[model samples]
Target chain A: MEQIIDKYRGDSTAMIAILHDLNAAFRYLPREALEIVSDRLSVPLSYLYSAATFYRSFDLEPCGEHEIQVCLGTACHVRGSERILDALSRRLGIKPGETTADGKFTLKRVNCLGACALGPLVSIDQKHHGHLTIHQAERLLEAYKDEHD
Target chain B: MMIEVKINGKPAEVPAGTTILAAARSCGVNIPTLCHHEALEPFGACRLCLVAIDDAGRQSIVAACNYPLEHSGLVVETGTSAVWQARKMSLKLLLARCPGVKVLQDLAREWAVDTKDLLLTEDRGEECILCGRCVRVCREVIGKSAISFAFRGVERRVSAPFDQEPDACLGCTACAFVCPTGAVKVIEQNGRRLIAPWHSNLEQVACKECGRAVAPLKMLAHLRGLAGEENEQAGEGVFCSRCRRLKTAAAVTALPEVKFPGPFMIP
Candidate 1:
């Protein structure tokens, strides 16, 4: 945390960058970590929390080891992305914003990935698996599960 | 330097960089506003102050509260049909959000806005218009940003960090005082000040002379710190407003009077 604050030279304007680094390191923002950042930067904790909540990228809760982001953008939705999301939710036994009980996978729905041509897109651990079918997505999840086991 | 601008075809000269709302008010033109406060910075959050502007035949609608009068000969129409339509739409949306608020209802009736055709989801019975006055006053004026707007979209609201009791709140009630919609409430009970919407409970500091409950202890400490005083003795010589006034009057009566040579008349 001190390194991250020092990296930004303790500049208040680098709040977003510092938060991003913290998120990357911890996979989510811990409440105590945010307090330390606020104290070190002399920025208000409420302000930092406001920014963290406003942006979708920052997760307040601990994320699962594997992240699965399904695009719910206009083009993707038109191509039956919601159906894919529902299928995954049932298979994983967790909703879009929830992490699995074993903390293996966290499912999220993103607005866009800027890749409209690949409608019904899904990204697993930042690796894009576009033009996916429900069966293929299940198989992909199975691969990660096998690797973990 | 002053710049000339015509508001609703009435010529008015206002200083440079003045907001259109201020310029209109200076010329006796009234622009209805809910989120505007003279003490705070212009936060164009509420869209109720929209007005039509025609600068050299280029026309556009802008919020009068924050839109500055940068150029001369800018024609501002406060009561144009477009302006009324915009304001009515804004009110209609606000009514849908806060159906129980009387101020929004009155504004809707005055503007003749019919929300009959407007379909609303569940009535949340919420009064906060998200005007951000309390947030701005706490951050800008009081210099303590104990509360802030959290979340986004329809789920957005003013809250303390993590929706927990605010750690930094002074219980100053400045947020409650500045809230236009009376959304923030300060309740005093059992010698404690409870700032609602954040649920911060602070012990009230008593006046040293009379032992009456004064301001909140944390708020007094904050003020004393602002005054560049050490906080070791938090309760020493502190007096409430009434006690302080009486003390000043008594001290004035006890002072010896001295005659001045010249008449103290201002030129």
Candidate 2:
């Protein structure tokens, strides 16, 4: 953390990159890392948390090895994404923002992925699955489960 | 030199860079606004202050709070039918997001907006309007970035660090006072001051005379420092404003000159 803050010369404007690097390294922002950043950059902890919460990409909690993001954009909403999300939640036995008990998957709902043309999209580990239904979503989950099993 | 602009078919002269809303208000034209405040910088988040502007034959609708009167020969319209429709639509959307807010409901009623089938999420309670006023005041005025708007869109909220208790909060209640929605709350109980929604528990400073909690400890120290009062003097025991006034009155009356009836005191 000191090395990262020094690399940015402790500039507060590079907060986003600093947070991204921390997130990349830890898979989520830890409180200790945020405190170090705040102290090193002389930025308020509240501001750091605010920036972290403002962006959707930043996560404050531990996520599963395979992160699942369901698109809840306008297009997806119109194409029955809620039912797909409900199905995913039921199959994983965890709602959005919750990780599965086995630590295999974490379900999250995102606003938009900018792929509105392909309505009802899901992304697992940065892999986009577009034009999906509840059955297909469950199958995709099964595939991941089988791969891990 | 003042710039002359026509607002609502009336010519008005205002200083350069004055916002259209200010100019309209100067001309006694009332324009409804939700997010704009006189103390903070202009944040054109709310679309309720939208106005139609015609500059050099090109017309556009812009938020009047941030629109500057920098140009001459500009025609501004505040009460057009199109403006009314846009405001109504914006209010309807806000009504959908926050059906529990009385101010929003009043605005909706004024605009004759039907509140039928609004997308009110039962999980979301009546809370901050995300106008950024509390956050701005906390950071800009108080110099305490103790709270801010966390998350984005529907997930946006005013919170402290990770929504936990804020360490840098001075318990000034600036956020609560500046908040438009009355979402931020400050309550003192059992010698502890709590700023709700953020849940910042601050230590209270007990008044010297009455033993009542007068203010937050940090707030008292900060204000005393700002006023050039020494910490030792404050530590000696501070009185609340009311108690201080009463003590001063008692001391003045107890003065030797007052009892002896000096020449000035004698009728």
Candidate 3:
């Protein structure tokens, strides 16, 4: 936390950059880091949380080891992304904002990853899997699970 | 300098930089607003106050709350057919968002927006309209910013940082007072004051006169600090604002009446 704050020289304007670094380091914004930044930057923790929640980039909860992003943008929505999301939710037994109990996978829905050409896309740890059907999505999840085991 | 603007075809002069809502208000032209509060900055979030503005030949529908009356001879239409149509749709969406809210219901009744056919799911139990009043007041007025709007679009909500209890919160009930929907509930339980939705709890201060919980300790301390007084360990509990006001009035009334010399007195 100190190193992250030091990199930004504790300047208030670098809040977003600092949060991004903290999120990247811890996979989410830790409470301890937020408190430290609040004290160091003279900004209230409330303000930090506001910034975190206002922007879609930050997460407050502990993310799973593997991040799964399902795109629900307009193009993807029309292409049956909801079915893919439903399948994933059923298989994982967790909704869009929840992580697996084993901490193996975290499922999330994004507006768009700018891959509209390949609609109904899902990204596993930032690896794009485009034009996915429910069956294909289940297979991909199994592959990841088998790889993990 | 005053800016001459026509609201509903009635010419009115107002100070420059006044918003169309305020301008309409000056000329007694009522423009309904949900997100606009007098104490907080105007947030053009709720489109209930949308009005058609004609600047010379060009015209566009704009949020009356934030649009400034910078230029003179601006034609503002507050209750035009087009404006009412836009406002009706906005009211309908708001009605759907906060299904059972009586305030929205009242607005719907006035606007003739039918909520029977509107799309609604099982009650989400969320009453906040995301007007941003409580958020702005907490930040700008209280300077504590204990709560803020999180997430985007439909998932937007007011909560403490990270949905955790905010340590900096004074539990002043400013959010509860400013909330138009009464979503933020402040509960006093067993010497502890709790602010719901934000999940902030603070020590309660007892009123000196009635022994009732008056305010949170931190809020009292902040107010005392603002009054430029050092923290003194006073043994007696202080009277609440109501009690203090009553005591002052009693003391004033109990004062001896001294009549001034009259110019002429009847024998």
lDDT of each: 0.90, 0.86, 0.87
Clashing pairs in 3: none
Candidate numbers, best lDDT first, in rank order = 1, 3, 2
Superior by lDDT: candidate 1 or candidate 3? 1
List the DockQ of the predictions in order: 0.85, 0.73, 0.67
Could you tell me which residue pairs clash in candidate 1? Answer: none
Number of the top-ranking candidate, with DockQ as the measure: 1
Model 3 Cα lDDT, one tens digit per residue, A27-99: 9998888889989999888778778876756788989999999999999999999999999999999999899
Flag regions of model 2 displaced more than 4 Å.
A70-90, A111-123, A127-149, B105-125, B227-235, B255-267
lDDT by residue (tens digit), candidate 1, A100-121: 9999999998889889999889
The fnat of each candidate, in order, is 0.90, 0.93, 0.80
Error of 1 at B179 (Å): 0.8
Where is model 1 more than 4 Å wrong at Cα?
B118-121, B244-267
Over the stretch B58-143, how does candidate 2's per-residue lDDT look in tens digits?
99999999988997899999989999888888887776667788899888878887666575445267666788888889888999
Write down the worst ten-residue block by lDDT for model 3 chain A.
Answer: A49-58
What is the lDDT for A106 in model 1?
A: 95
Summing lDDT over every window of 10 consecutive residues in candidate 2 chain B, give the lowest-scoring window: B258-267
Residue clash pairs of candidate 2: A53-B151
Instruction: For each candidate, give its TM-score against the true structure.
Output: 0.92, 0.84, 0.87
